[model samples]
Target: MTDRTPPAPSLAQLRALIAVADAGGFGEAAAEYGVSQSSLSEAVAKLEALAGRPLLRRTPGGTVPTEAGARVLTHARAAVQAAADALLAAQEENGGLSGTLRVASMRSAATHLLPPALAAFRARHPRVTVALLDSDAGGGGAPAVRSGRADLAVILADEAPDLRLSPLPPDEYLFVAPAARGTHPVTLAELGAAPLILPPHLDSCYRRIRTYLAARGVSLTAVSEVEQDSVILSMVGHGLGVTVMPRLALLPLPPGLVALPLPEPLARPLALAALPHRAGLPVIRAFTQAVLSHLPVPELPAKEPGPLPVPVSAPPLN
Candidate 1:
């Protein structure tokens, strides 16, 4: 004879046996499961046979599990709960919202969007640790998400289509010049005529500024092209040339530079993208909510965002 054991008892049979013990008899268990008492009894019998032990003793003190039955019931309840937890985990995974969330964002988010939200999320969930891959330019975000490097990304508007796109609050772009340039606002046309330190074409703000100027039939002298906002602003502070940037990006302006709104209002759109399953996790939700609450839509002077690190060659123009 083979010395192999019988296949383990099926979960369904274990469940039926537990129900009978709980409900006092097969008749009651059958009523609960909408099956016949005979069927329920057969199910329990199958469970006992697989376990190679008698599970219940009916000695007129109402039906009760024998010692063996009690042990099986203990494991059955645990197994059921474990199975339920696994199912919930699978659902969360399918919805793209739960599990460890990794993020990569362009400079604006790295500097402005993530700090507060990340702090808040940490306070709430000390167990969840976030990996912030600092990417000042938008190019890093797409590969991070697509290659499973990051769960989500807050990239430039131009990079939105490369992954998934979600439009953020509208924000205006302004020209920043040395404070010595004075407080008078300049027309978009005139501003375009000034020597400009611009971001590379891969940057969304760069493309937006270029498009806005082209549409207005204005062309400025392009002096320098930089990859990051801080560097571009630093170049401006150094008397390199004036540059255009979203209002939120101006918070940490150098001492000598003053921000001037363009005569014609222009808005730069920001967006968030993620792999299909990355958006739904609890951490992502909490992080996104915290960011949205902290990053105001209006450029209110009193609600100005915190200072960010900008490469400053000298104090801003004053």
Candidate 2:
């Protein structure tokens, strides 16, 4: 009698699984990989057959990995990344850099921080393609890098302790309220006077602000929790309430509003995150240098010794 053994999964199948999971649906994944949905689905089906278990589940929200699927995905991502690195290494040996460098970043950073750096990197390594994935959720960038969906992630500093981080200048948080309220360094009392409108509790910036205020014996609750920075600003503009947000998110502050320093200054530190093992890759190194070279050092507001009662001129908005 001859023994029959199951076929080993191919790298193509592994990549298909990763793509579906990351993209969150068969149609989207197919579009991204430039393959038909049937082909992508077949690849994942084959992978599941080899493992003898269901890997993905369909839901109203989107396709998501099942528990077993999630476990397999971690290995799939590692395997796919390793294969890419091997290919990249071979290409680098020829003294040329050619491949995609995926970067995950929050929307604000993507808008304000990455353009110059990306332009500089493209100029230096025209052969290498750069993909920017917008991750709007707080600290969403770190998870994308950890899952091997991105080579680098622009995120809050110290957001992921296990990942290697390259720190960038911090973005100061400012108190924003109606211009009718008058422009003055906000007192702790005034901060609590208005019904607070703030980012969702899951937001890293919100957590930082909450913690900082908690330490100072200030406990305030948000009357409305919003995720979009622009919406929050608009809400404040309409006198819904006041908010504290990172300076980068409040740029070009809407007309009829003012931003002032908090009674005690606070800031959100930013960083580029990468898996420790891949931190030394030539492409990663090149892009890191580009970011450092092109990103201007932010001019943070000077720290006040204490809250001032007199109104101060609001900083110029550009």
Candidate 3:
């Protein structure tokens, strides 16, 4: 048997190493963990030395785990999770759900859904801090939830997930343009003729919009593609072209634009997702409750099922 000193690896070292690997770079990992790169690097180096083998390899784009590094990372993540579970369990035993509640959401949700709920939630749980982020489009919210950086995510739901997800409330898609343009609703076939501003191909809204139109044998003529709601709304306000956006986005509409409900009645269901292990936490439960209490659901069509316990709120308009 070989005699080797079993190094005591600190949680900090494991976290630094994991963050760098997940973030794909030292700078990003350091920023995420609120540590200087040098400090993070030192911690990672110490971890590698303790492990008795090199665990990571520096690449042009970022750092990647070598074969040995991947093993270390897997175990490190497990250990970190165990430690977190222990801490959360201890907190539960000693106190109530009182800690920072990190939330990641899309911009439209941030603008319309979060404010009132957050305000009410704050009044109820004054000790629990809230951190909300409008993460990148294309559902980058997944990373925030998976990384433990966010306790909960209110986002466009992916059909299949590696995490537990619960549907919040449904939001509708609308073909919005300047109100001065017209009152009559335009069909997808007719609107396919006009130049359009649209979401990027990878965006859930864009993909769903495409699928709906495609199913009806229609397609919008694209003038340009943009990633955020604000840009699309601004372009519509300027009469650059019409764009399809969630009705919730109407809350932040520029002066000249108006949103008309789509005839198709296609509703995108939003969801709250967290690691399955974290689903039972009070913070997650409270956050989910806060979400259910805030989403401004639209009127359901006669044939459709009644809206979920959608909070009574005004139309998705300013």
The candidate scoring highest on TM-score is: 2
Model 2 lDDT tens row, 1-318: 776885778999999998998899999999998999999999999999999999999999999999999999999989989988876655552376888899998776776777878876776688998988877743488888988878999888766889989988788888888888875567887776678888888777778887887888875754578988889999998999999988778766788788888887799889999899888888887788788787755664456422212322232212
Backbone clashes for every candidate come to: 12, 0, 0
> Which wins on TM-score, candidate 1 or candidate 3?
3
- Residue range 1-318, candidate 1, lDDT tens digits: 877875877778867877888789877778887988887788888888888889987867667999999888878866654454354345432233334556787655566556766776665666656777755543477776664546667766665575666656666677788777776657766676778888777666777888888888887766578877788888888887888888667766668788876767788667777655445545555666666665543545323322223432322111
Off by over 4 Å in 1: 1-99, 162-166, 301-318
Per-candidate TM-scores read 0.58, 0.83, 0.79
- Estimate the TM-score for candidate 2: 0.83
Model 2 pairs whose backbones collide: none
The window of 10 residues in a row where model 1 has the poorest summed lDDT is: 309-318
Give the runs in model 3 whose Cα sits over 4 Å from its true position.
1-8, 19-42, 50-52, 59-75, 92-95, 137-139, 219-223, 297-318
* Lowest summed lDDT window (length 10), candidate 2: 308-317
Predicted candidate 3 versus true structure: per-residue lDDT over 1-318, tens digit per residue: 897867699999998889888888789888887889999889999998988888888888678988998888777887887687665655551255676777888777776677777877777777878988767643467777776667787766765378788886677777777768765666776568767788888777888887877888876666588977788888787878888777676665566666665667787888878888887776677777776777665555444322112245533321
Rank all candidate structures by their lDDT, best first, as comma-separated numbers.
2, 3, 1
Model 2 misplacement above 4 A: 1-7, 20-32, 36-42, 57-64, 91-94, 137-139, 219-222, 300-318
